[model samples]
Target chain A: MTKNLSNVNQIIAKYQGDQSALIQMLLEIQRENRWLPKPVLARLSQKLGIPISQIYHIATFYKAFSLIPQGRHTVSVCLGTACHVRGAPRLLDRVTDTLKLNPGETSVDYKFTLKTVNCLGCCALGPVMVVDGEYYGKPSAKEIEKVIANCD
Target chain B: MKKLQKVTLTINDREVTAKEGMTILEAARDAGIYIPTLCYHEKLAPYGACRICTVELSRNGRSRLVTSCVYTVENGLIVKTESPKVIKVRKLLLELMLASSPAKAIQDLARQYGIEKRRFEADKTNCILCGLCVRYCSEIKQANAIGFVGRGTERRVVFHPEIASTVCASCRECFSLCPTGKLPSETDGVCFDDLTLDDFLKTQQSPA
Candidate 1:
């Protein structure tokens, strides 16, 4: 617990303990820790003099922050307007069947987190599924299986 | 000391003088005019979360609805607190709130406006989300123990267990400020594991 807390102290020090950079500090913490643990948030609230309630408010407000632990690999299926018309739903089904996890849920083994995004800003790559920063446009079920198997 | 500036404006065709920077609601109330409101508290800042205090403001023949709590008074601004346009908006807002909450305060206002039935499908979370309790806890008490979490339809009040467990048992000042009266009764702390308000109270009573 103390080992994890020293990293939190480093992140806070990087910001020079500025109160206005609360959101930025939290995002960095989330990136390193995979989630904002309650103890980390409480420590931030104490050091910054901002209340824990306020920190929790910011944590839950943005879609980027995660209060709970996320998986090692993030699998996001684009459900954008272009993708919707071009078999995004079918693509999502294949991913879910392989992962056995619904959208916004992490796998029981913590291997992958499956979530749907409105857009990945690549309309040309309609029905795109991004797994661990690698994008596949309209990938087959076998390809998805290979992708999941590749991730340790 | 700077002198308080005054401005004159028409409310329901009655010419009234009000202090400069005072809201239209405050001016109307000073003139003994009635404007219904659910989320306006004198102590708290003007949130304008509940649009029940919406009034029609007409200037130079251009009319639009504005929440009286947040809108500051201006010269030559014709304010209508009970116009047909204002009534229609307030009624719809009341209907939306009525569908979500069965609180006595909302029901009483609906009755006053003759809102007999809610047209929308009931998705009652029993929280109108007027944000009174959250704002009061942050602003008045300076103890940001309770606050809102999530966004849009998922948004609801939550009492932070770490802070609330220490500060809330004795200082539940936001309890009386809640219009729904659900804060005290709803023992569930809404989020942050299974920690409830009762648990907080228990922690306080047991002494360390």
Candidate 2:
């Protein structure tokens, strides 16, 4: 947690101490840290002199920022038309069963966060799952278990 | 008049110089190094949402990933706009963005990169974080009626409180800007083909 704060401070410093760059800076910070915590928001508010309420508002308003701690691995399922017609729902169910978590929920051990997306644009490979920045296409229920095992 | 400061930098191992305030993207373009980007136009300020223009820069012997669109050229900056790491990150970013918004435009680009399947399952939700509609309605059209509501994973553009009416003019400015044609309409509720809300908003504006 302290490390996250220090990282936020570094980001704040990169913006030349400007609060207006809050959104972009926070985006970058989140990219590095995976998620933003409330304490970090307070620190940003104090550093930038912006009200904590305003920071909270902006944080809540943007779809990019997350208030909770994210899992170590994030699995995003693509449900584009091609994927949908190709049994993406079945794949989603398999993933949820394998991970034991619902969509948008993280595993109890924080090993994985399961999420579903509209489309990955790779229709040729329906039922795509992107895990920890790695792409996996046309994965079956069994294949997903192998992939998760490989991650471990 | 304030004197414009010049900064010398290296892009793709080639030496080039640019104005201090110039973005690394501008300097690279001037130097003939092409960096792929979306949501970045010369006429508008950099949005940095695409994350495709990320470059690996080594400054003071430390390296970091910086978006070329927003990063300014600095003296002694050694930048590699295209590297193995940079390519990987760009591809991942593209994959993530594509997953969020399943559109023909995104698919075409993904095909170019040989991304056959996203590693994750598909999300049924249609909203992508492109912010094009938000920008058009708020910035270009100056309507500011519909804006992004919700945060992180649940973020979406809707009339406040998910109600039908608030500030939305229903000019369909957002509909046109939407890449997937998934904007909400009154006719069929959430169906893509329904445009009753759009028509109603138009009627409200003209009010014959």
Candidate number with greatest lDDT: 1
lDDT of 2 by residue, B57-135 (tens): 9977789999999998889899997788897887787688766677776677677666766876566555566667556
The two-chain DockQ for each candidate, comma-separated, is: 0.44, 0.07
Candidate 2, residue A77: the lDDT equals: 82
Q: What is each model's TM-score for chain A? A: 0.94, 0.87
What interface RMSD do all candidates show, one decimal each?
12.4, 14.3
Can you give the lDDT of residue B61 in candidate 1? 83
DockQ category of candidate 2: incorrect
RMSD each, Å: 5.4, 15.8
> What would the per-residue lDDT of candidate 1 be over residues A1-152, giving only the tens digit for each residue?
68668988999899999999999998998878777887898899899999877888788788777777889899989998999999999999899899988887877787788878889888788889999789998899999999989999
For each candidate in the order shown, give its overall lDDT on alpha carbons: 0.83, 0.71
Q: Write the residue-wise lDDT of candidate 2 on A1-152 in tens digits.
A: 89989988889889987977999988987788777777787788778976544564576566456666678888888877888888888888888888888776767687887777787678887778898878888887788999988876
Question: C-alpha displacement of B167 in model 2, angstroms?
Answer: 9.2
The model with the greatest TM-score is: 1
